[model samples]
Target chain A: MKARVTVTLKTGILDPQGKAIEGALKSLGVAGIASVRQGKVFDIELAGADPAQAEAALKDAADKLLANTVIENYNIEVRS
Target chain B: MKARVTVTLKTGILDPQGKAIEGALKSLGVAGIASVRQGKVFDIELAGADPAQAEAALKDAADKLLANTVIENYNIEVRS
Candidate 1:
């Protein structure tokens, strides 16, 4: 089974790294960019075929370690 | 317009951060684990609704600033 978790900053949060990227993009002549918000992607290979169990484990992992829930939000998807 | 850029390290590359996270997850009692790899996600808001143009701009942005193409591979998706 394969699982992916995406963690992103919540709205109204200041993202300096994203700002830096946006500025860098403009300087590189890549126009049409208004804003950029950066986040994290985690790809995991699990040992089971049970989607429900895998999703539960991944959600727990996201809550416990993968994300800082106060400042960021995380979503999980499992594929078998 | 909206675009998403996913940047991930290529295979065989040394990812110390990902290794550390894997160890952390193990310590946190996240079982059924085989392996973990960490990457980056960028959510971009563009000024134009043209999906093709937005996709091109985001791909350029990812190539130039969002990702180090030498060690990383980036995927770009544009949504209108």
Candidate 2:
């Protein structure tokens, strides 16, 4: 199985890096940009486990390497 | 309007940071024993623009700052 994890900053957090990127975009003659926030994604390959088992494993992965829950939120999707 | 941009390492790109995170996770005893890949996301708020216009702006953002297209790919989602 394969799992895709998306990690995003929590609302209300100050995203300086994202803002910097937005600014850079505007300077590059890329108009219409209003704002920007940032996040992460993880694509993992599992050991051909069942969906439930995969979910459990993925949760473990999230708690460990995928996210810092204090500042970020993560969502996981599993595919065969 | 708001736009979400997810930037991920292209397949076949070596992700040392992701590997390091995986190792850290394992040492933390949070084991699923899987591989890890890392990516980035950007959430943007527009100036009350339509989805189509927002998408154009987002593309510019991605091209300029949100992603290093040499190794990263981005997807944009617009929400009102």
Q: For this target, which candidate reaches the highest lDDT against the unseen true structure?
A: 1
- Per-residue lDDT of model 1, residues A1-80, tens digit only: 99899999999989999999888888889999999999999989988888998998898899999999999999998878
lDDT of 2 by residue, A1-80 (tens): 78898888888989898888777877788877777777878888777579888888888878766789999898989988
Per-model TM-score (chain A alone) = 0.96, 0.94
Q: Estimate each model's TM-score.
A: 0.96, 0.87
Instruction: Score candidate 1 by DockQ.
Output: 0.93
Docking class of 2: medium
Best by TM-score: 1
Cα error of candidate 2 at position B59, Å:
1.5
TM-score of chain A of 2: 0.94
Off by over 4 Å in 2: none
